[model samples]
Every structure is written in structure tokens, then in C-alpha cells.
Target: MAKNTSGRGQRELRVKVKTARGRKLSSTLWLERQLNDPYVQRAKREGYRGRAAFKIEEIDDKFRFLVPGARVVDLGCAPGGWLQIAVPRINALGEKSGKRMGRIIGIDLQEVEPVPGAEIHVLDFLEDDADDKVKGWLDGKADLVMSDMAAASSGHKQTDHLRIMALCEAAAYFAFDVLEEGGTFVAKVLAGGAEGDLQKVLKQKFTKVAYMKPGASRSDSSEKFVVATGFRG
Candidate 1:
């Protein structure tokens, strides 16, 4: 079951969504969970595009990778939430006084609405030439490459786990190509038996690798983030 908010001066009367005549129970349950989720409400109140913005927010809060003057690349950057968070933190718009300006490029398979102070591209990061293209766009190697990509769910747990691990590994290899020496890579992955291989691979390339589950993530979710820093390039 999903958690709900309470306490004085906060929300009351948890929203209950009755199933429509043709709706599936899963759909009804999902709607109810979204309505009750505190992070979703906070996203609306704080002007983030979605709750996922907070995941990166929490991740970067600890890693401190989104510093001013850092050049960043965001793979699978749909809806532009990560870009929105990176812009100000990286000083993409030069809003911070006496801080170095930063640059970020976001790529996705679908066209995303433009986020101010960031560049967005419709691209698939798996293409053979994708790394070259991103290099061309950035005009230099990136200081950090991050991803929020996940494979489409097939409703089978093991298959889903393997699929996401494979995607995360691909993102890691892509990072190896475009990241500058000592850069960072952050990505999402599921917890499963096969992740040991992914960890082994990252350990070879990064000086430090750590995992974190942000508070914004649902307690029931299997998702966690891998933050690999000090790219050995």
C-alpha cells in the first residue's frame, strides 16, 4: 500500500479513486498511489516537472557532482526534470555571482519540451555514433554523464531486472567514451543477482562506487542509484 500525509497545517482527507467501469484494478491503484504520494505533491508545490527531480536532487546533494562549471550530459532526459535541477546548480545560466558557468545537454528518444538554460536533443544513446554526436554537441568531453533510463517493464520480475541491468551497463560504457578523466556517472538500477557484474565493471573504471536509495523513492520500489565517481579514463 502507498503512504499518505498527515499532521496539522498539512494535507488531510487522502484521495480515494474509485475504479471506473472499464479501468483495470492496477490502474486504479496506481492513480490512488500518485494522489497520496507526498513527493508528487511537493513537486507540484516546488515547481519541479515531476517527482523524479528529487531523486537526482538527493543524489547530487550527497555526491556534489552538479557544481558550477561542470559540463554535464543527461541520457534519457525526458520531461527535463534532471535538466531543470542541473541548470541552476551547475550555473548554466550564470545566475550565481562569481561562480563559473556550466553547460548541460539532454538526449532522449522522444522530443522533450525545452528546459530553459539547458539544451535538449531527440536521440537514442545506444546508437553506434551516439557518443561521437554528443561530443560534437558539447564541443568537449563531459565532466559528468548521468542517466535515468529503464527498460520497458515486461511484467516478469527476473526479465525486468536483467533488462534494466543491461541498460545501465550500456549507459556505463557510453559514459566511458565521453567522460573526461575523473568525471562522474550516476544511473538507476534494480537490485538483483546480476548486478554484481555491473559493480565489477564500474569498480574497474571509477575510483569510488556507492549506492543510495533516495527518500523520494517509494518504499516498495526496488530502484536505487549507482554513483560512480573519479572516472579513471
Candidate 2:
């Protein structure tokens, strides 16, 4: 049984719709699982733009990244959940607070509603023009470059994994281009594991590179995060 911590049980309560009419079994199962997910209920209660915010939060708590005043860039930042977490964490240190002052800029192909203190741009990071736009917005190098982008699934497991790996590789290249020395880069990867070539490149560029799966991520999901810290520039 999922507890409604918000005290608004009625609002959080999802209708348990039985499979009816033409609804496929898989679709109905997916809907039922989502409805019963605790994180989804918490996200709704907390007013987060999306439940993905918790993944970043849990990752940060473990790694102690995203320090005060850090200049950060978020790739595939649609719905602005990560940005929502980044702003307060970055701002918390205040002036003269630390090595990196909070400055978060997010980019996505989809439009995201403005987050109070974040600079957001609507553009695909894969486009040639996108880098210049993000750089212009940043005005300097970034302390961290994080991406949660995943390619659309093809239902074929290997194909889907390869597509997401490609996205991660592209994101890493962009991270290398923009990250300041001693910076950090994080991106989502599938359980099939990162491509060997990409792993070799990341290991050479960063002092520490490791994979993590946060508690917010569904246990059954294959998703994991690759964190590369101490950028050598």
C-alpha cells in the first residue's frame, strides 16, 4: 500500500482502471504501475515538475556534487525537474560561498516553463548551432555538465541500448568541450553498459569515473548514471 505523505490522499489517489475495450495488456499494466508508484505520489505532492528530480537529488546526496554557485549545464532538461533541484542547491552557499557559484543553464528540444532562477533555452543539444547558444548563455565554462537524455525506444533491447549510448557519447563530447578543469560530467546510460571506446575516453579525461543507480530509479529499470569527476581539461 502506498502512503500519501502529502495528506491529500484523495488528490493523489489514481483511479484503478481495469483493462477495458481495446487497451492492450502492456499499456494497462504500465498505467497501473505508474498509478501505484510512491515517487510519483511524492512528486505530485511536492509540486516538482517531474519525478525525475529525485534521481538527481539522490545522486547528488551520495556524490556531494552540485556545490554552491556552481556553473552547471543540463542537457535534455525538459520539464525542468533537475533545474528545480539545481537552483536552490547552487544558491544556498550565497556570495563568496565557494569555488563555484550557482549558475544553472538548461537546454532541451521541448519547451519548459521558466524556473525562477535558471536560464533555459529550447533547442536540441545535437544541433551544430546549439553549442554556441548555450555558450552565449553561459558566458564562460561550466563546472558541471549533466544529461538525462535517452533515445526513443525501439522495443528491441539491444537497439534501444545502442541508441541511448549514442546520445550519452554525444553528451560527453559536449561536456569535454565546455567543462572547466576539475569539473564533473554525468549522463544516463543503459544496463547494457557504456560502449568500450566511450568508457576509455571518459577514463582518460577524468580522475574518477563510476556508475551509479539512485534509489529513485525503479529497481526493475535498466537505467543507470555514469559520473565522471575531476575533469582534466
Candidate 3:
């Protein structure tokens, strides 16, 4: 059994992990952090798929974009956490009386186990005519197009940053093609020098563009979310 290292109580308890012989130090550290993360515990208790759900929840709560009847597209929605959050907030189940039902469409390179009220597809959003396919599934334009996609890490920080930026730019273009006028685009991005170009493009197309690092994000991480609302086109 693991012991609490930060003093035990309802509010202050931290789990400590001892390194195992076969585990790399980095892996051990990650496991320890997961065990100690309050968001992880909260997610489990609240029946969410993972901690990343809170990041999107916080963003949507502040921005007021995931309303009832809004159509949403979630890019690279793996492990189905974001989908779980979206279903209830968007009233996809028609459980919210008097509110119109919403739609959720998610796509990824790999197959995701179905999320109850969401339509999850296995497709790379960057491929040819992918935007058309997504629109076909939704049957119309989306009110919001969001992405939590990050490229596979190359063990080189700068290289990884550029790759993710490229992915974000691609998602932005897809949003441009399929979003309704006054729509929204939300995506995760790393804080690096190369993001200026992406920001420029977003500013041109959106009435308001804001950057946020949600409280659920780690303090040491450079990841931030770019929320461009009030789409001009």
C-alpha cells in the first residue's frame, strides 16, 4: 500500500511512489504525479475519462460556447474524455427539458470506443476532403470546432513544437471550411516563438482571440489554449 507523504486529511494527502527496478525514473515520476494529482482523483470520483476533461470544461464554462443545440466537432478526441464532457453540456441526449438537442462529432487517427451521445469516426482530419466528410456527418456547419491534438513527440522539444503548431494551423483551416458564421475555434498550443503566424491568421478570421492556460494544466508545462470566438466568416 502507498503511504501519503503530504500529511493525511480530506484536503491534504499526497501519494508517494517508489521506483521499481524495471521502471525508468521518468515513468516512475509520471506515475507518482498521476497518483497525486487532484484533478485525476476528481475525475475518477466524477466518472470522467481523464483529467483533460476539466481543461475543456473550464474553457467552455468561461466562454459559454457549448450551449444546448450547438453543433460541435472535436478533433483528435481520443480516450473519449472530451466527448464525455460535451454530451451533457450540449444536451445531446435531450435530457434537458425545453432545451434543443445538440450534436457532437469527433474524429481521430485511431478508433475510439463509442461515447454514448457522440459520433466518433476514425479519420485523420488533415487528409484530403476530410472537411467534407466531417460536414457530411454533421449534416451542416458546426457551431464549434475544437482540437486537443498534439503530434507524436520526437524527443526533441523544438521539433515537437513545430509539428504541433503545424497541426494547429491545419485544424484552423478545417474550422474555416466547416464552421458557421459566428462560430468558435478552440485548440491546445504550446507556448513557443513560432506561434505568432498562427495567431495572425486566427486574428484575421475571428472577432476575438484569447489565450489561456487552464488551472488543470501543469504549472511547468508550456501548453495553452487558443480560443478564437465570433468567427467572421
Candidate 4:
């Protein structure tokens, strides 16, 4: 169990479970892992919207992507975690006189609480109308398009992987349509690698396409990020 040490004095509590209660082994393991994860505790102390913020932070640090004043679009940005990290970076640049003001737009089917300096919309990215809605909000081409979208797990690994791939492909298509020439796209994908067809398309459209798994992501997790930069459009 992780202790809350922020001077709030929140004690860690453990609940007893009976061995014969029929709880699944996977569920028990998941709960135990969450209880012990230091990042989870740190996220709580820092008031981040989610622990996923650290994943983006680690990736951005390594890649030197996500520059200040970049026009960034965050797909599937529920709970506004990524936006929370991005907004501050952009704002810091604007603090200097004559720097270009940055714009960040976020979309999710789930309603997100407003984050200062970001425009958010609630709509399913898979719907037929989603593209039009996002275009309208964008006002102009984006410098960066990023998605952390993940399909709900069905407990079947193959099915879940396919669903996530479908989402990634859809997001990639949208990125191709909306990103400016020389722009970038980043998305979350499963361990099987992006669908081959999608990889082929990204290679044709962008100067660089690569897959990265940040250190903040759990070793046991299959999630990785696909980054396509220097869009030809």
C-alpha cells in the first residue's frame, strides 16, 4: 500500500478479502498494482487529471516534440489530462512578448471539465458527423494531432487489439485531413504494431513514422504510441 505523504495525512487503508470469496486473480492483481504504483500516488498529490499525463510527459521529453505555440489537437482527450500538460507549455511561451499564441482543441465522447485556454467538444470521433464538428472547431489546420483513444476492453485480447487499431486508423485518417504540411500526428496503439495498411499509408504521407513506448507506461501493458511527423499535406 502507498502512503499519502503530502502533509494531508491521508492514511492508506487496506480492506480484508476472504480467500473463498471468488474474486478473480486478475482483479486482485490489478488492485494490488494500483495500490503500489508510485506514479498513481504522485498524480494524486500533483492534482493531475489522470496518471496518463506522465506518459505524454515522458514521450515529449524524449522526442523534443510538442513545441511551445504549436497548434495541437487532442483526440479522445477525456478528463483533459493531456490538455493539462500542453496548455501550460504553450502558455509559458506566450508569456514572452511577440511569440505566437498557441491553440489546443480537445474532443471526446465523454464530457470533460473545462481546462483553462483549451476548447473542448463532446462527440464521438467515430460518428459520421464527427469530422465536420472537429473541422469547425479547428478553424484552421493543426500543427499536431494526438489521440489517446482506447476501445473498452472486452477481456478478449484479439478483439480489443482490433478495436484499438480501428480507432487508431480512424484517427490517422482524420489527422491526414486536418494536419498542415510538415505537421505531426501521435496516437496510442497496441503491441501488435499498427495495422500494416495504416503503417503503409502513414509512411506515404509523412517523412517519419515511428513507434514509441514511454517509460511511464507499465511494462506489462501492451499500449504504445505511433508518431508520424512532417506530414506532406
Scored against the true structure, residue 219 in model 4 reaches a CA lDDT of 88
Residue-level lDDT of model 4, residues 1-233, one tens digit each, is 98767756465555444334677877777777776777777788898887798888887877666777788889989888899888876663366467667888898877899988889888777677776677677777888999888999999988998999999999998887778899999999897744788889999999999989987788888999988889999
Error of 3 at 185 (Å): 0.2
Best TM-score among the predictions, by candidate number: 1
CA shift of 8, model 4, Å:
20
Residue 129's lDDT in candidate 4: 72
The TM-scores of all predictions, comma-separated, are 0.95, 0.88, 0.94, 0.85
Off by over 4 Å in 3: 1-11
> How many steric clashes between backbone atoms does each model show?
0, 5, 0, 0
Ranking by TM-score: 1, 3, 2, 4
How far is 163's C-alpha from truth in model 2 (Å)?
A: 0.3
**Best-fitting candidate, scored by lDDT:** 1
lDDT of 3: 0.94
Q: RMSD to native for every prediction?
A: 4.4, 4.7, 3.5, 5.0
Best of the two (3, 4) by lDDT: 3
Candidates ranked, most accurate by lDDT first: 1, 3, 2, 4
lDDT of each: 0.95, 0.87, 0.94, 0.83
For candidate 3, the clash count comes to: 0
